[model samples]
Target chain A: MKIAVDAAGGDFQPENPVKGAIQAVNENAHISVCLVGPEAPVRKELEGLDYPEDRLTVHDAPEIIGMDESPAQAVKTKTRSSIVVGLGMHQKGMVNGFVSAGNTGALMAASAFILGRLDGIIRPTIATFFPTIKGQGLMIDAGANLEVKPEMLFQFGIMGKIFASDIMGIETPRVGLLNVGEEKEKGSETLKKAHQLLEALPSFVGNIEGRDILAGNADVFVCDGITGNILLKFGESIPEALQTLLFAAMKKNQIDGEQKKLVGGLLKEAFAPFDYQAVGGVPFLGVNGISMVGHGGSSPEAIKNMIVNAARMAEIDINKKIITSIA
Target chain B: MKIAVDAAGGDFQPENPVKGAIQAVNENAHISVCLVGPEAPVRKELEGLDYPEDRLTVHDAPEIIGMDESPAQAVKTKTRSSIVVGLGMHQKGMVNGFVSAGNTGALMAASAFILGRLDGIIRPTIATFFPTIKGQGLMIDAGANLEVKPEMLFQFGIMGKIFASDIMGIETPRVGLLNVGEEKEKGSETLKKAHQLLEALPSFVGNIEGRDILAGNADVFVCDGITGNILLKFGESIPEALQTLLFAAMKKNQIDGEQKKLVGGLLKEAFAPFDYQAVGGVPFLGVNGISMVGHGGSSPEAIKNMIVNAARMAEIDINKKIITSIA
Candidate 1:
């Protein structure tokens, strides 16, 4: 199967995507990659790279989307953009899936516009993998739809369960509704309604508190994109801040010089585990096509891993299984 | 000055409160404590404590509210409960402030009903102290008013600012409207309206993302309790989870035992500077009487610190200052 990578996406742009695509193509024998972006910068970054020509091809789309630009405006104006072109390839069945680290809004809009929502799926949810002590937990609706109903949350639980079982290989993954407290009556009207609906669900673990998300309380933690997004950012940003502080303290000799280095290194390392890049891209489920959106700060290694992850989703027929389960 | 202490409140009740009240009497020259709870158990726990009798009086309120009891029902049923008696003392002007580690809901309701909302304040907010790197931050409405409008948020901001400056001793404390992103246009309609309203206020620091809460990005972080409750619990829970995991790993020798211990100790120390014990009780701003709620996890030291904090609040006439400043 062929996968399309948006080379014009992300903060590092052509270099990370180009290097990562080449690496992914080299490693995965059954998968081929079509890098979509401007040929000049992509090729320059690809210089001296030893990649399988048959498996690695470039599909140039000169236009790019800016971070600040409105997603709706970009989709309307930048018809030949890399994201749009990549979505086109998936629509035509030229590629099995598409990946981008670009504007999240644009990716969601373009993917939904091109491939449409899967059967029985009203709106797609962003599924991010949160690394926990019990293994990686599937944190669904990380930043897809802001305002969601109880029905949507129930759907998120179903989709998250499938993602965990099929992709992460967790059998009967425990589903937990991320709430302020564990009690069903603890949350807002939306949460209370969702909790009642989730109780009837198979493999439901009841309401898990915010603390439980990182504590590895459940294999699958589900919430609306708004709260999920807030939690995701809080988890990501805190560790980043801690690591930075640890480094600064060590550099300034604010802590015990020799002891601080050792302690600081370990603290930093512990904090590093929570970083977004280490977990790769969050897959946008419920769409007809398999598409992933990596963080803007992701490195080549992370992008390469995301490519592999997306390929595995295609290989395991995740989209088909999700569609079947939801239906 | 007279202060009422709920001797039977908290996870480690009677012992902590008894020892704490004794400690407060010993430490404060002019302070008198009225320990409210069941007489026999409180006396049994206070057996070893040595303090002046005139300063330490027990106002027996035999009934106690369990942590799991419904807040509204508990308040309605347990009329002569320790928490209620303590709140009543505040209302009667017999005590300058009331301290409790009892049911949060019961405390909020009792305080609101007994003390009544200050003029222009609709609902009483539970302002909690947040442990931040650059000192502690105040996040009010931590879970008081779940569904909050821009008007309520504006009041929260004003009260939070007043508490920060008058109580925490931070001048011109920066106030932030918690949102998904830093952009002004980001977040829901309430947030946008709140953002605009907050901007017009003198101390408003614009929109702050969830990640910034722990980084000490602003002196006061404001949000609706639904979101605030989640964020506050999220912050408190993550560190607790990390500590648990770290200790578990250390116990199994899965990591460098000595090094891990040392780092843990340092983090415990660095984080100690902002521990709840040091911050004492969260002042119930916009209320007639000075009221603070200690955490159930608070130790004897925490209780003593809270008494001192409450005394300081009384000394500075925080309530009068806030009323005038907002007016």
Candidate 2:
């Protein structure tokens, strides 16, 4: 299967995405990559890399969408950008899927406008992997629709459930609505209506609170994009905040550097399993085609994983499952 | 000023509340407390304590409201419950303030019903202490109003600012609208409107993302109840989650018990300064009277601090400042 990778994406640009695409093709015999970027830089980054020549190729798309540019404006103006061109390839069946670590807003905007929505999809959502104690949990609407209708959330549940089952390998994943309280009639009007609608699914768990996010209470947590985005960002900040507090305490207590190093090492070790970098990218589910967006600071390995995951998503034909489920 | 303590409130019950009132009066000579609960049990618990007899007294309030009871229903039925009776006393000018560690919803309902809202207050908000690296910040609408209008959030910012400046001891606290993005036109329609309204205040800081919460970017973080409630619950869950993950990692690495103990001790010390228990209770800002609610499992020390804080709130007359500012 063919998958297009945005080499002009992420903080590392062509280097990480270029190397990541090469690695994915080298590791997966069935997979071939079309790296979309400025040809000169892409080739220069690929100079020392050894790979299966026939399985990997480059597509020149000189324009770049910056991380700070207006998503809609950037997509409109930068038609030749890698994100635009890569997804265009997928839209026309030139590639089976497209992956990028570029601007999230631009990617989401471009994906919806270019590929259109899958059948029965009200609004496509950004689904993110939540690090939980027991295992990984998937949260949908991770900053797509700001204000969601009840039915929209119900659809998110379906999309999240399919993604979790097909891609993340959690069969019959328990879906929970993220709310203020655990009770059925909790939260805003939108959440209340969403709860009633989500009850149609046998795997639907009742409302889960913020405390449940990392407690492994639900496999798939559904919420409006605002809550999900805030939760995702808040979750990302915990390690740094804890470390700051920990260091202050260590200094005040006059603990020796050796002990501090030991504690620090232990912290890093514990956090390793739940690191965002290791997970690579998250999918903007409910889009017509497979489109994944990784972190801006994604490593080559993470980029590699994103490409492979994109291929796996296409192989499973997740959109068809989502369409059927939501229908 | 006279304050009433809920003897039937909190997990520790009459013991903690009884001793806490004694400690508050003992420590703060200007403050006096009336312990409110079932007369027999409260008086019996208060026996043998060497408190200033004139400064400390017990008031009869026989009915008990369970933590799990429906808040509005419980307030309507359990008229003589401590939360109800204590607020009633404040309403009747018998006490200057009331403090409880009982059901949050029940207290909010009863407080609003009994004491009423301050002049020009749109919706009374429950403002809780946000523990940041710099110090304690206050987040308003912490599960009081589920769906907030733009004007209501603007009022929350004003209430939060007054509470922070008067009670939290910050001068001109930086107030921010908690949102999904930092841009001016970001988030839902309500947030954008709220941002425009908040611009009237000189202390207003534009939209703050989820990452800014723990980093101490703003002293007064204002959002709708759902966001604030979720953020509060999520913050409360972090330490326990971290500990669980840390233990599993330690077991995996086979770290010695002694080192684990040392690391654990350091973690606890660091977390102590930011402990919610240490902060005691948070105020239901915009309420006509001073009303504070502590943690369910509040210690005697926490209860003492809550009572003292409640008295301080009365002394500062924070509601008057809120009314003045919002007007």
Candidate 3:
């Protein structure tokens, strides 16, 4: 399977993507990567790196899309941008899938516009993986759609189920609507209606609350993008907040220098499990074909894993499964 | 100020509330306490306690309200319950305010039904105190309204400002509408419209994301009840989750038992500052009278704090300020 990588994407640009693409081809035997960017610049990043010469190729495209640009405006204006060109290659069936650590809005916009959504799909969404005690769980509409209709929320559950089952290997993946309370009557009119719609699925576990997310109560948690995004951001801020609070405690207790270091080391070790980049790329579910996006600050290893995961999705034909399931 | 305490409220019941009432009267000079519950049980709790003869008294209330009972049904059926009696006394001007650590929903229902909402108030909401690096930031509609209109959100901001200014002692409290992004155009149509509505306030700081919550970005974080409730529960779950994750890390790192205890002690010390109960009680703002609710698992100290806070609210005539400001 040939997967295109947006070389001009992410905060680090062509160097990280180039080094990562080389790592992907080196690590995975059967997959070839197409680096999409300006020819000379991308090739310059490829210099002195030991890569499979035949498998690693550069697809020249001159323009670049920024992280902060407006999604629709940028996609329309930056036609020759790496994101557009890479997705263009995948749209024409020249590549099986595309991956990027670019502007999430731009990636989603360009993917939906270029490759289009699958049949029976209302709107494609970004489903992010959240680490849980029981393993990884998927939260749909992480930041894609700010507001969603009941029908759309129900569809997100269906898509989440398929993605979790086929991609994450959870058998009979359970989907839960995120609500204020577990009772069916709780939350806004939209959430209550969405709860009813989600009940049609046998895997629906009624409604789950915020605390249930960390407990791994459900394999998939579906909600509007606003809730998911806020929670995601809030969860990210916990470690720093804890560290600050902990330091204040240490100072108050007069633990001094040596004991502080030991305690700090232990705290760091405990928080080590929350490495978001290790998950590689999170696929934009309900799209016509495989497309994924990593965190903007993702490292080279994360990019390599994204390439491998994209290839696996192509091999597994997860998109076809989603289409069949939804139909 | 004479503030009634529901002696039958909270998990600890007559013992904690009765003891707490004595503590409140003892701690605050000019304030008196009236314990509301079954006269026999409440008197038994106060038998050995030393309290000012003229400052502390008990009002007979035979019925009891359970935490899990339906709010409307409980309020309707349990007429002689401490919650009902205490609120009834407040409504009749026998007491300046009522405080409870019982079912939050039932308290809100009874408070709204008996004491009524302040005139011109769109809806009465519970604004809970959140501890931040700078100080406590109030989040309105914590769980009072499941769904809120743009008008209600704007009103929450106003009520929150008055409470923060009059009670919390902030000179010019800032209010921020919680959204997925800080941009004016970001989030759902409801949020965007709410953003426009909030612009009328000189203290409105555009929109704040979830990350801004702990950093005390605004004195009051305004949102629908669902968002606030979810975030509150999520925050409460962090310490335990961190402990679980930390223990796992400790086991993996092969720390000895002595070292484990030391690390655990330091961790606890760090989390020591997150005493939600210390804030006493959160007032149900926009109500016609002073009514506050503490955590269900409140200790005697928490109960005492609640009573003191209720008395302070009565003294400050917070309700009058809310009415004046909203008008």
Candidate achieving the largest DockQ:
2
State each model's C-alpha RMSD to the native: 2.6, 1.1, 1.7
In candidate 2, stretches whose alpha carbon ends up further than 4 angstroms from where it belongs are: none
All candidates: DockQ: 0.46, 0.84, 0.68
Across residues B1-327, which tens digit of lDDT does each residue of candidate 1 receive?
A: 778888888898998888889999998988888899999998888776689999998988999998888888888889989988888987988888888877777888888888888877766787888877777789978888877788788888988998888778887799998877788888778888889888877899898877787788899989878667777766766556666545554555455657776657655655454455555677777778878788888888888877777877777887777666556
Cα lDDT for residue B57, model 1?
89
Q: Each candidate's lDDT (Cα)?
A: 0.81, 0.90, 0.87
Task: Put down candidate 1 lDDT per residue, A1-327, tens digits, no spaces.
Answer: 788999999999998898889888888899899999988898888889899989999998999997667888898799999999999999998998999888888998898888899899978888888767566888888878767888889889988998888877898899999876788898889889999988887889999876677778898888877677777777777666565544554555456767765655555455556768766788888999899989887788888878888888988898888777776
Give the local distance difference test score of model 1. 0.81
Docking quality tier of candidate 1?
acceptable
Model 3 lDDT vs. the true structure? 0.87
Model 1 clashes, total count:
0
RMSD of 2: 1.1
True contacts kept of each: 0.36, 0.79, 0.60
For candidate 3, lDDT tens digit of each residue in A17-104? 8888999999888999999998998998888889899999999989988999998999999999999999999999999999999998
Q: What TM-score goes with each of the models? A: 0.93, 0.99, 0.97
- Ranking by lDDT, best first? 2, 3, 1
- CAPRI docking class of candidate 3: medium
Tens-place lDDT digits, model 2, residues A95-190: 999999999999999999999999888888999998888789998989999999999999999888888988899977999999999999998889
